[model samples]
Target chain A: MISLFLDTSSKKLVVILVKDKEIIGKKELESINDHSSYLVPFIKELLDLNNIKTNDINKIFVVNGPGSFTGTRIGVTVGKVLAFSNNIPVIPVSSLKQYIFSLENYDYYVSIIKDKNNRMYYGIYDKDYNDIVVDKYQTKDVFLKDINDLKNVVFISEEEIDGIDTIKPILNINKLIDYYKDKEINAHYLKPNYLKKIDAEDKL
Target chain B: MNEYKLTTRCEEDTISIAENLEAEKFPGMVICLNGELGSGKTVFTKGFAAALGISETITSPTFNIIKEYLNGEMPLYHMDIYRLEDNPESTGLLDYFDKDGVVIIEWANMIEDYLPEERLDVYFKVIEEDKRIIKFIPHGQKYEELCEDAL
Candidate 1:
C-alpha cells in the first residue's frame, strides 16, 4: 500500500511518499506566501520521481495547522481533494503532534510554534505521546512558567526560545503514519486547527 | 523611575517581552504604550491578551477607543488614545484605571495628564522593518519588579 504525506502549516512545504512503511521519496520546499501556487505541482513531481501515480496512493496524511492560516488551508485542501477524488482514507495530523513524534525518548515533551506577537501554539505530551497538556495559544512567559519546574522535559520549536532548553524538530513521516494508522477521517470532515481566531472572525 | 532598554531584532523578541510581562499581570496594572504607527503597540497587546487566556482575536481598538475583553484570566482594557489627541478628557475613561483589570493604553502620550502617576511606560522605536528598540520606564516599585520579572 502506498501512502502520501503533506505538511504546509509553516513556511516549509514538505511532501513524503511511503510504500508499505518505507519512505520511497520525500521533498521539502521553504517558501513564504507561495504554498497555493507550488503545493500541487510539488506533490505531482514528488510522485513522478518515485514512479508512483496519484491513483496508487491508498491513504493521505496532512499536517492540519496551528501554523499559518493560508498555508494550512492550502495543504488541507489539497489533501482533501486528492483523498476524496481517489476514494482514499485521509488522516489529519496536528503540527504539534508531528513535532513530538519527531523527538526521541523523553519523559515530557513540549512542542511549540510561534504565532504572531509572541503568542505560541503549544502542546505538551507524555512519553507515549499522550496529551498531558492541550494545544492552545499562550504567551511565552506563561508557557515557560507552566513547564518551568518540569523534570526531564524537552522543548521543540522552529524558533529559538530564551530561558529554555529547546531544539528544532526533525519531521518524521514514517512515525506519523504508524502513530495515526487507524485514526483516518473522511476528507470532508478534515479542517485546519487554527487555535487563534482570524481577524475577520473576531467580531462575533 | 527606573528605565530599562531592550533592542529586539524581530517581532518574536518583542512578543517574548510581552509574554513575560503577561506572566506578571496584576489587577489595576496600567501599561502606557508610546510609538509611531506600525511600531508594534497592537502586537504587544495581542501577546498580553493571549497570556491572560483570551482566545478571541485582538486588534487595535482605534475606532472604538476602548474595547473590554472579560473572557480571559482577568479583564483586559485595551485602549487606543490616538484619536483623543484633541480631547483627552472623557469621564468614562477615568473609570477604567480602577476597574481592577489590566489596562494597556496605546498612543498613551496623547493623554499623559490623565494617566496615573504609578504606571509602566513603554516607548517603541522602529530601527528596521523587523527590528525595534523598546524602552521600559517603571514608575513604581511594583512596576519595577514587573520589568525585572518580564525582561
Candidate 2:
C-alpha cells in the first residue's frame, strides 16, 4: 500500500510519498507563501514524478494545522478533495503534534504552532508517549500563565525554532507513516486537534 | 552599561553569530538587539532565527512590533520597537514581550523600560561600507551565561 502526505501549514510546502516504511519520493519548497497558486500543482507533480496515479494511492495524510489559518485551510481542503475524489481515506494530523513525531527522542516535548491572534498551539508529550496539553492553543498570557516556570519543557515548532532553549520544530513525516502502518490503520479522517475555540458561540 | 565587541562582515553574518550564540544560550532569557537604522540589526535577527531552525522568511517587525516564526525546530519572536516611538508605555506591545518564545528586538533603545532588566543586550554600529561592530552584553546571571556562550 502507498501513502501520500502533505504538510502546508506554514511558508513551506512539504509533500511526501511512502511505501512499506520507506519514502518513495518527496519535495519541499521553502517559503512558498502562495499556497492557493502552488499547492495543487505541487501535488500533481509529486504524483507524476512517482509514476503513481491518484487512484493507486491507498491513503492520504495531511497536517491539519494550528498554523497559517489560510495555509491550513488550503492544504486541508486539497487533502479532502483528493481523498474524496480518489475514494481514499484521509488522515488529518495535527500540524503541532506532527512536531512531536518529528523530534525522535526526548523526555518531554512542548510543541507550539503559530496562532496569528498572538497565541500558540501548545501541548506536551512524555517519553512514554503520553501526551498532555499544558495549555491548549491560546495567546501569550494564557501560555505564560500556564507555564510559569520552564523546567523540562522542550518547546517545538516549525517557526521561531531558535528562541526556545529546547528542541527544534522539524516535523518527521516518516515516523507518522510507520506509526499508522504498524497499527494496521489505513487512511482515516484524523482531524486537526487544534485547541483553538471559535469566537462564535452556539445557540444559547 | 556593559559591553563586548565583535566584528561581522554583513547582516546575515551577524545573524549567524547570533544563531550560534542562541543555540547554547539559556531559555526564559530576554535578549535585546539595539542598533541604528540600517545597522544590520534585522539581518542579525535573521541569522538567529536560522540558528533556531526557523526556515521562514525573516524581516523587520518595524510596523507590526512583533512577528513570531514557528516554521523550524524552535519558536522565534521577532520584535521591532521602532513603532513604539508614539507610545512607549502602550499595553499591547508590552504584553507581546510577556509571551513565551525567544524574542529579538530591533530599535530596543526606543523602549528601554518596557524590556526586562535581566536580558541580553546587543548593540550594532556601522563602521564603513559592509562593516559592522556588534557588542553583546548580559544583564544578569542568565544573560551573562548567554554572553559567554555567544562569545
The stretch of ten residues in a row with the least summed lDDT in candidate 2 chain B is B89-98
Query: Who wins the lDDT comparison?
Result: 1
Chain A TM-score from candidate 1: 0.91
lDDT of 1 by residue, B1-151 (tens): 6789999987788888999999998988999999999998998899889889999999999988899999999899999987764454322475467467899999888888668778999999999999999999998888999998888
What TM-score results for chain B when candidate 1 is compared with the true chain B?
Answer: 0.95
**If scored against the real structure, what TM-score would every candidate get?**
0.57, 0.50
State the lDDT of candidate 2 residue by residue for A1-204, as single tens digits.
889888887667888888766788887888654677887887788778878899898878887776655667677888888888888877766666676776646676777765443556677667654566543666566666555664555777655733455456675667776554343223345444434452232111
Candidate 1 chain B weakest lDDT stretch, 10 residues: B86-95
Worst lDDT run of 10 residues, candidate 1 chain A, spans A195-204
Model 1 stretches with alpha carbons more than 4 Å out: A197-204, B1-151
Give the interface-residue alpha carbon RMSD of model 2: 10.9
Docking class of 1: incorrect
Off by over 4 Å in 2: A114-118, A145-153, A159-164, A180-204, B1-151
